[model samples]
Target: MTANASRAISWGEASARRMERQFLARPAGRGTRVAEVVAAMLGAHAQVLSAAEVSVGVRAAGVTRADVRAALWDDRSLVKTFGPRGTVHLLPAAELPLWCAALTAIPTGPSPFPPDVRVTEEQAAQIVAAIGEALDGVCLTVEELGQEVVARTGPWAGDLVMPAFQDLWPRWRQVLHRAGQSGALCFGPNRGRKVTYTRPPAFDPGPVPEEAALRELARRYLRAYGPATPQHFAKWLAAPAGWAALLFRELAEAGAVEEVAFEGSGAWVAAGDTEFPGGRVRGVRLLPYFDAYAIAARPRESLFPGEAYRRALAGGQAGNFPVLLVDGVVAGVWHQRRQGRRTTVTVELIGRRLTARQERELGEQVERVGDVLETKAQLVVGKVTVGPHA
Candidate 1:
């Protein structure tokens, strides 16, 4: 923190600066590598893999969904795995070691399941190891992997204890994410419609050490979405608030971070990351479902101001509605429906008005979105129906 810095940065300016840092206010994400975009944003949320590709594509110039898949499966530059909050994400493959160490270092809470259904710590470790061994040098569907895991361990490991969708999941399934966070598992190319799992490409971040890995991860988050607090980070990682607060204290004592006032509240930014961009970030962008910026940015009220505060969020969660961003704030909600070779983009601008020039920019942005998805996009100013993706 700059000692007695002149003035606190307003929430508006802070939001604009974050846009620049996140590559939203600049040229299509400043790099060609899909992994580059993934790293900058920490990870692309991948519960919907196609949406994940859009999250990356909109950030980078000339990149497409195929490019994201190539990085994941062909070039192996991006690894599909459980990342922050144990949600499916596409993380930079080379950073798996660091990601694994930092993620595994997060403090965990007690299980939600009853004792009869719960996976004990010893059982979890054993199952994780079995998962690693079963997927090494080969790709296997969940059923096939379950067979191998049961064979390697015991039938007790395969007891259907966890309820998922319409069926029950095996006891070992609880550790599936742990296996990925331990760098022993990742996603593989789909065999037709069936998904497959495989081991990471044999790189480990153990040399970085957990403490160092965590420090770097903190710095990365601050650099991309900073002037933030540990609570925001804790929420992003689903880690404990106390654990996150302690981490910030450590960073502060080491002089790796500086405190600054953000909207009158004290926040920390990475050391030397003091420059705030001048003027508002003027642009109209249609961000896809689960876009990192929508999910990770701080001060939700400011990000989703006015009517946007209600419409853009679902159950107090961001990323449910595809956002129509105007000058770094959520101004509306949009939806994309792709049929064959064309994508129809329906946007409802709320809470703000646009100039003629800004409206033109919105049209161009819609066209760029089509380019990202490799489809011809038609823009319509109307209500966006929120349901399953069309």
Candidate 2:
């Protein structure tokens, strides 16, 4: 049998290695830059802006909320855009082109929009083009974008045909993500409180080919959360299963990836990135809801074993609850409440107990979080009375 079919890798080793790769086994060195951390974590989820800041701040040493904002607005090193699973994310600006190419390469499934209300492929293309022109060198809120698109693409593009947030949205809004996937749009600095969009500033060496982009993206995903199956990748990106399977087949045929036995099932890892950590991961982390590490790790049984499978998960969906990870596995649930300079972090262990040293480590973790957010955090080891997310 080929090494791909015979070599076995266990879940413990996989989880440990993944933790280190995600900068969770330990805080990354002080020199680890914000953009670098964002890239390694496969983009911080930005739906909850403060949570995204905390996600990056807690992982890399010396990275603060100010640092993340500076990298986003000042350095222009990071770009806020629609990313994996069609969620808002903060991706490294330099990789935007490849991200667009790779994401668009995925075979999209049927639209959720009703047939009569949906934009045809041609209409979506027109809206995407109009969005590019409208956002070029200008920042526009959703309302502003809608008006400019109507001017450019006619009344059909401005019809209130799509449903959103218990109300109707413009037909062209359906293609908002398409604009992001085409590298024609991204989030700009917020105006007071409203989110704005802009076309990224031009840079040398434009987007790579779709095939090359998809291949490189697969490799990057494996590097960050490797030994993963096509199903895992598909679920992570909300892509069609058949498409991801074919992509993996193409990768294997090209000798770019190798199949391996993970736990009991078969999985693939990038050919050059099969190395596992030599020791167990030792630490406790309070990962915010939608944190990349909490969302991307596989073998849900192992990572969320026992009570965690019941408590930390929300109706079987991961990343909806702030997880308390012990030695890289979810051991409890936590919630945080911020008031001015002081934040109260509440913990509720479901199945396991931390040793005295682990408790001390948890205290240090709280302090470290305070430093990152520039707040004072108090840790409470009791019932988490607050609701799920902070």
Candidate 3:
């Protein structure tokens, strides 16, 4: 049988099972950050969270900077986790080599740059050097650092310079990676707040075999977000769709992964037996803006429906509500407003008929937020509604 056909899982069942397992495995005390939990959840959803939905997920998951910091240490797990699309993410540090391997060709090619955006090697070098010098001993914001590079490069810095910088961000990230390697940049104050860059400690600058990297990436992708189609992985990784298919083929042949069928959809899962939690799910979480649960799945409709998905994912769009997930499905949207010592949580559902238990659960969640934020929370429930003003 084809690999994809061999390892598929029912999406909802897997999601529910994974969520239960995670909540139960939550580390005690201030040990693991909510970010790590969120990462694990998304990894369970499969290794990619969308750049758009991450913030919400993080907040809802109650992950903080501290949690994210702790999780970045697994080199193969973390570095490649972020920066897949000029946006940042938390990846398993051990999987970086694989992600970098898969993406190396994309960043190096001519197509990554539009025709209007011209950045010659010399200009790039100058910008890099200026940035390196300016950030050598100080931690500056992007705007501050960019201005310095702009002043040094003059008009030749190009019109699409910011995009170019974004394009070259990974290369620049490598500089920080180098710094991290030399111990020049370790995890600063708050999960890399003090460090000039957000990347974790770097690896030795040595050649990594391309095949091995690809294999590892494929394996991680499957392990974390298995029962997923190759298309799903491609979308999550922001890689060319064909690349995902090829990689899956290579890994499956190596006996690193298998396929499963879930709810009529086909996906791949990790090779070994997986365990999950057995319990009824209940909770109304207010996810942070960049939480992993929302971002990891591509096409989003795989989890959320069509128009709802569009409104949420589209950029320059507002009023896409913060989601309230009930039983692993989007039940309503929530919003939080902070006023001095009080935080008001507003819930607008697609339906007003929430079970009494669901309402109580939601109230408790709001209270939990209040406790965490050290503010009194006012919970307001409203009807199902959508609009720019809603």
Among these predicted structures, which one has the highest TM-score?
Answer: 2
Q: Order of candidates by lDDT, top first?
A: 2, 1, 3
For 114-209, candidate 2 gives per-residue lDDT tens digits of 898898889999999999999999999999999999999999888897899999898999889879877889999989999999997675586589
Compose the digit string of candidate 1's lDDT tens values, residues 35-111: 87788889999988988988888778888888888898898999999999988999998998899999999988788
RMSD in Å for all candidates: 2.0, 2.1, 6.9
Cα TM-score of candidate 3:
0.68
RMSD (Cα, Å) of model 2: 2.1
The models' CA-based lDDT, in order, is: 0.86, 0.87, 0.50
lDDT of 3 by residue, 1-390 (tens): 122344334456566554443452222244444434444544322122222223322333454333343344332234422344433445445434444555443323344555445456565556556665665645566545556666766754523333434454322332332332222232222324332333334545554677776666566555555556788777665567777788788777888877666657656666763443343345555544444455553335655654455544436322245576666655666666779989888777654467888889788767766655556889988643444323
Candidate that scores best on lDDT: 2
Question: Of models 1 and 3, which has the larger lDDT?
Answer: 1
Residue 149 alpha-carbon offset, candidate 3, angstroms: 4.4
| Over 4 Å off, model 2 | 1-7, 388-390
Error of 2 at 263 (Å): 0.8
In candidate 1, position 102 carries an lDDT of 95
Candidate 2 yields a Cα-based lDDT of 0.87
